[model samples]
Target: MKPVLWMKSSCTTCRNAKAKLAELGLEVEVRDYFKKPLEAGELEHLLPADPAPMLGTKSPKYKELGLKDRHLSKAEAISLMVQDNNLLKRPILVHPKGTVIGFDAEAYARLVR
Candidate 1:
């Protein structure tokens, strides 16, 4: 299967990831999570069970929503992310070998190459 890149169009990291994939001559399927939000199952598959990695702690929305103080379970976090794609960290690259969350140039190179 072709690697799938879950990303937002406006994110610089997402753009960089896409460019790097191209540079490596790897064909990828891009999924704009903003336009098409991820389902719960998809989120569960992409994210860690801990939910901390899936949650975008740095997002203003997280602060605005006052989620920092709240301890959300895996299900709650997954549900929240499904409702709001912005709650997720951008540029999740899914490959046959493994999945990489966020932008890691070295990881991308290792997986894509």
Candidate 2:
């Protein structure tokens, strides 16, 4: 299957990730999560059991929600992400090899290799 990339178009990191993928000759299916928010079931399927890795800690929305202070459960995190897509970290790459939460050139290379 072609690798799927979940990213925000406005994020520079996400843009860089796309360029890197293209440089690697990877034709990826890009999912602009900001435009089309992810469903709870979709996030559950794409994310690991612990969804913290997928959470965007630096997101303004995250701070607005005061998630840093609270100890949230896996379910709670997922619920919050569903409620607000901004809570999710961008450029999540899903491939047959594995799922990568951020843009790592080496990881991207290994994933498609």
Candidate 3:
């Protein structure tokens, strides 16, 4: 199966990831998650069993939304992400081998190769 890249157009990391994929000559289906939000099932598949990986803990909105004090289950975290695309990390790359969250050049290279 072709790789799928879930990203936001305005994010620099996402842009870089997209460029890297292109540079590697790998075909990808790009999904701007903000424009076309992910479904709960999709998020479940993309995220790890732990909520921390998918949850954007560094996002300002995370604090603004008062999520810092709360302990969310995996389902809850996915629900929140579905409601606010900003709550999810950027440039999630999904391949047949595995998935990569966020921008890591080394990881991308391994996946692309």
Candidate 4:
């Protein structure tokens, strides 16, 4: 499968990630998650057993729920993220090799190389 970039179009970080991918000459299918959020089953398929890496700790809802101090099961985390797309980290590259959350210049470059 081709690499799919899951992100929120309104987010600056997501936009920068997209630009970085372009700069790397890596074409990907963009999924504006906010516009078309994924279902729990879909997220389960994409994410590993521990979905913590995919959680958006910086999101207001995460803070509102005090998730930082709380320990959540994989099911709980996916539930929250599915309920609020904002709860999911932006610019997740669902590549053939694996999934990557947030923008990492080196990791993104490695996808194509």
Best by TM-score: 4
Better of 1 and 2 by TM-score: 2
lDDT of 4 at 80: 88
**Model 4 stretches astray by more than 4 angstroms:** none
Give the whole-model CA lDDT for all candidates, comma-separated. Answer: 0.86, 0.87, 0.86, 0.87
Question: Candidate 2 on 3-112: residue-level lDDT in tens?
Answer: 89899999999999999999999899999999999998898787777777778998898999887777777788889898888888888988877888888999998866
Candidate 1: tens digits of C-alpha lDDT, residues 37-90: 899998877777777776787788789889988878889888888878889988
Evaluate residue 2 in candidate 1 and report its C-alpha lDDT on the 0 to 100 scale. Answer: 88
Q: Across residues 19-97, which tens digit of lDDT does each residue of candidate 3 receive? A: 9888888789999988889999988878777777666777888989888788778898888898888899888889897
Error of 2 at 30 (Å): 0.8
| Model 3: ten consecutive residues of lowest lDDT | 48-57
Error of 2 at 93 (Å): 0.4
Total colliding residue pairs, candidate 4: 0
- Regarding lDDT, does 2 or 4 come out ahead? 4
Query: Candidate 4: lDDT of 56?
Result: 88
How far out, in Å, is residue 14 in model 2? 0.5
- Per-candidate TM-scores read 0.89, 0.91, 0.90, 0.94
Could you give candidate 4's per-residue lDDT for residues 30-87 as a string of tens digits? 9997899899988888777877788888999999999988878889988888889898
RMSD in order of candidates: 1.6, 1.3, 1.5, 1.0
Error of 4 at 55 (Å): 1.0
Stretch of 10 with least lDDT, candidate 2: 44-53
